[model samples]
Target chain A: MIGAGVLWWLSAPDDITRPYAADVTPDIQAGALVFAAGGCASCHAAPEAKGDAKLHLAGGLAFDSDFGTFYAPNISSDAAAGIGTWTLEDFARAVTKGVSPQGRHYYPAFPYTAYARMTPQDVADLHAYMATLPADATPSKPHDVGFPFNIRRSVGLWKFMFSDTRDVLTDAQTPQIARGRYLVEGLSHCGECHTPRNALGALDRNAWLSGAANPSGKGRIPGITPAQLDWSEADLIEYLTSGFTPDYDSAGGKMADVVANLAQLPEADRAAIAAYLKALP
Target chain B: MTGFTKTILGTGLCAALIASAGFAASHSSVTNKAVAARHAQMQMIGYHTGVLGAIAKGEMEYDSAMVDAAATNLRELAKLDGTTMWVAGTEQGATDGSRAKAEIWSDAAGFAQKFTDLENAASAMIGAADAAAVGAAMGGIGGSCKGCHQDYRGPKS
Candidate 1:
C-alpha cells in the first residue's frame, strides 16, 4: 500500500521549473489575435454576455459531458477568485501542461491536451493580453462529477496514456498550410468538438475532424472532411467570416461563437484554414 | 353562401379530414404541421437575409427598390406572431426536419424575445438611408438571427 501511494505521488507531473523568458516583452496586439483564435470567451465568459462584455471572462458556462457537468471557472484577473496573481510561467504550465500552480491535475475538459502544442511565445503573449482585460471576482462553481472520475489524480494517468503530441498533418505544402495546421490542431482546437472521441473521452486522432455525436445531446456534430464537406476553398473562407452556408442557412449553436471569433481574424487566416481543410485527405 | 365559396370550404374540410385520418395512428399530424410551418417561415427569413447580405457584400448591386422590398418583407416576417408554429412537441426529436431545440417551448419568453430582436433590427434596416447604411445595419440584423438560432436551433439532421 505504501509503495503504491508513493508511485501515485511520483506519477503526478513534476513541478514546472522551466522559466518563461523574463526580458522578452510580449506584444499585446499579437496576443489579442491569439486570444481570438483560442476562443477563450466562448467557454469562460458568462452565458448572457455579448459584445464587449465577453472580455470579462467571469466563467459560469456549464459543459455537460458523460462523466459529469463541468463549469468553466473564473479566468478573469480577479486577484482572489481568478488567476490575477499568476505569473506567466504559472499560466503557461496551466495552459500547456494541464497542471495548476499548486501542482494538481486539471480535468481534460480544459482542452490543455490540444493547447500542449502551442509555442511558448504565443503562451506568453496570451498571458499578457489576458492581463489587460477587466477583472471579475465571481467565485467558480464546483464541478458535479462523481468518483472515481472525481479523483483529479486519475487525469494524470489518462494524460500519460493518451496525450500524443505528434502533429496531425505532416505534409504541409506551404507555410500557409503549416500555419493552418498549427491553428486547427493547436490553438483553435477545432477537433475538440468536430472529432469523435473514445469511451475514455480522449479525442480519436484517427477520425480527426470527421464529426461526433454532439456532447450536448440530441444531434450529431457534422463532419467537415472532404467527403462530408465538398465546399470550395472560397466557400469555406466566406462561411467562416459570415456564418452563411451555401444554402443560405445561418450558423447556429456553438458555431456562431466560433464564427464571431474567426470573423475578427484576417481574411488570409480564414483562407489558410480553407486551404488546410481542402488539403486534408 | 355562393356556390364557389361552398365548394372551396367543402374541399378544405375534406382535405383536413383526410390529413388527420392518414396520421391518426401516431397522431402527430398537428405537431408535424406546426414544425413545417415554422420551417417555411425560417426559410423565408433566410431568403431575405441572403438578399440583404448580397447587397452588403457588393455581390449584388444596391438598388433602393430592391432594398426596400426585402427590408419590408423581413420586417413583416419578424412581426408575425408565429406562436402556433412553435407549439409544444414540435422540438427536434418530436418532428422531422425541425431542428428546433426544446428550449423554444421551455423558455417561451426568451424565444419570443429573439423575434422581437429581429423585428427591431429589421425596422432599422427599413429606415436606413442608403446601401452603406443598410450594410452598417446588417451586423445587428444578422446577430439577431444568430442570437435565437444559437440557443434555440439544433444541428441539421
Candidate 2:
C-alpha cells in the first residue's frame, strides 16, 4: 500500500494550462451553448429538477451500473463542496485529464476520456459559464464500487490504456463535418455508450458507434454508424432534433435525453452532426 | 441503403404493412412474430412523428398540407389495435430482436397508463392545425413517449 501510494504521488498529472486570453472576456453566450452541448445537466443537476431549477449544480444523480452506483459531484461554485476555487488550469486538468485539484485520478464514469478532446478555448468558455451557475452546499454521494475500483491510483493505468485527447476527425475537408465530428465524438460522447467496449471498459474504436450492450446492464444499444444504420442525413437530423428515428422508431432510453439536449442546439449544428455521420466511410 | 441496410428496411416496411393489415393476427411463431408486429407499428409511429418533428425542429419548411398529413398519420396510429402485438415472452431478454423490457408484460397497469397518456397527447396533436400549434404539442408528445420508455422499453439494440 505504501509503495502504491508513493507511486501515485510520483505519477502527478501533467496539468494543461489555459492559453492566456486576457482580452476576450469569457464568452458567456458561447459558453451557454457549450454547457448545453456538454449535456452537463443530465448528470450534474438534481435528478427531479425542472425549469430554471435545473441550473443548480447540486450533482447527486445515481448512475446505476454493473460496476456500482457512481454519484456526480457538486460542480456548483461552492468553495467547500464544489469547484469554486479551482483555477482555469485546475478545471482543465480535471475535465481533460481526470485529475483532481489535489492530483488524484477520477473514475472513467466521469467521461473525461471524451471531454479531453475539447479545445482549450471551449474548456475556458465552459469554465466561465459554470462560474455563473448557482452553487449548492449539498454533499456528493459516495460511489459503491469495491476495493480495486476504489483505489484512485489504479485509474492511471486505465488512462494509459484508453485515454484519447485528439479530435475525432481533425483532418476533415469541410468545416461542417469537422464540427459534427466534434459534437458527436467530443462534446456529446455518443460513442461512449453507442460503441461496444472491451473487457477493460475502453471503447472499441474499430466499431465506433456500431452499437453495444448497455454497460448499465439492461438491453442493447443500437449501432449508429452509417454502415450499420441506413438512415439518410435528413432522417438522422430529424432523429437528433426530435428523438424520432428512421422508420418512425422514437428514441427511448438515455438517448431521449441526449436528443433533448441536441434539440437545444441550432438546426444547422444538428444538420452538421447528420452530415458527419453520413460522410463516415 | 445497401446489403443488410436495404434488407432491414425492406423487412421493416413489409412487416409494418402486413401487421397493419392484420393478416397475421392469428399467427404464432417462435421467432419474428409479435416483436416484428410491434416494431412495425412503432416505425409507422416514427414516420408520422418524423414529419411533425422535422417542422418543430426547423428541419423542414412548414406547410399546412404536410401538417395535416402528419396529423392524420398520428390520429390513425393512435387508434390502431396494437393489443395483439404483445405476444407472450417477447421482451428484451426472452427475445433476440427487441428491446422491449419484461416490465411491459409484468407492469400491466403502468403500461396502460402510459399508453393512455400517449393517446391523449396524440389526440391533442391531431387537433392542432398550424405548425406552431403542432410545435406547442410536441413537448407533451415527447414526454408521453419517454414516460412509457422509462419503465417498459429497454435501450435500442
Among these predicted structures, which one has the highest TM-score? 1
lDDT of each residue in A1-281, candidate 1, tens digit only = 99888659755874554766565678888899889999999999998798899999999899999999999999998999899999998998899889999988898889888888888778889999999999999999999999889988888888877888688887999999998888888899998999999999999989999999998887889899898898889779878987876545668899999999999998888998989898888
Q: What is the CAPRI rating of model 2's predicted complex?
A: acceptable
Error of 1 at A12 (Å): 2.4
Off by over 4 Å in 1: A1-10, A14-17, B1-31, B127-134
Q: For residues B1-157, could you state the per-residue lDDT of candidate 1 as single tens digits? A: 5576456445543443443343232233334787767666766776677667666765555656666787889888988888687788777877776788888878889998999998888888885666688788887788888888899998855
Residue range B1-157, candidate 2, lDDT tens digits: 3476445445544544543344233223326677877766665666666666656655555556666777667766766765898766777767766677777778777777776787788777765666578789887777777767656788644
What does candidate 2's lDDT look like per residue over A43-65, in tens digits?
Answer: 89888666687789899988776
The candidate that wins on DockQ is 2
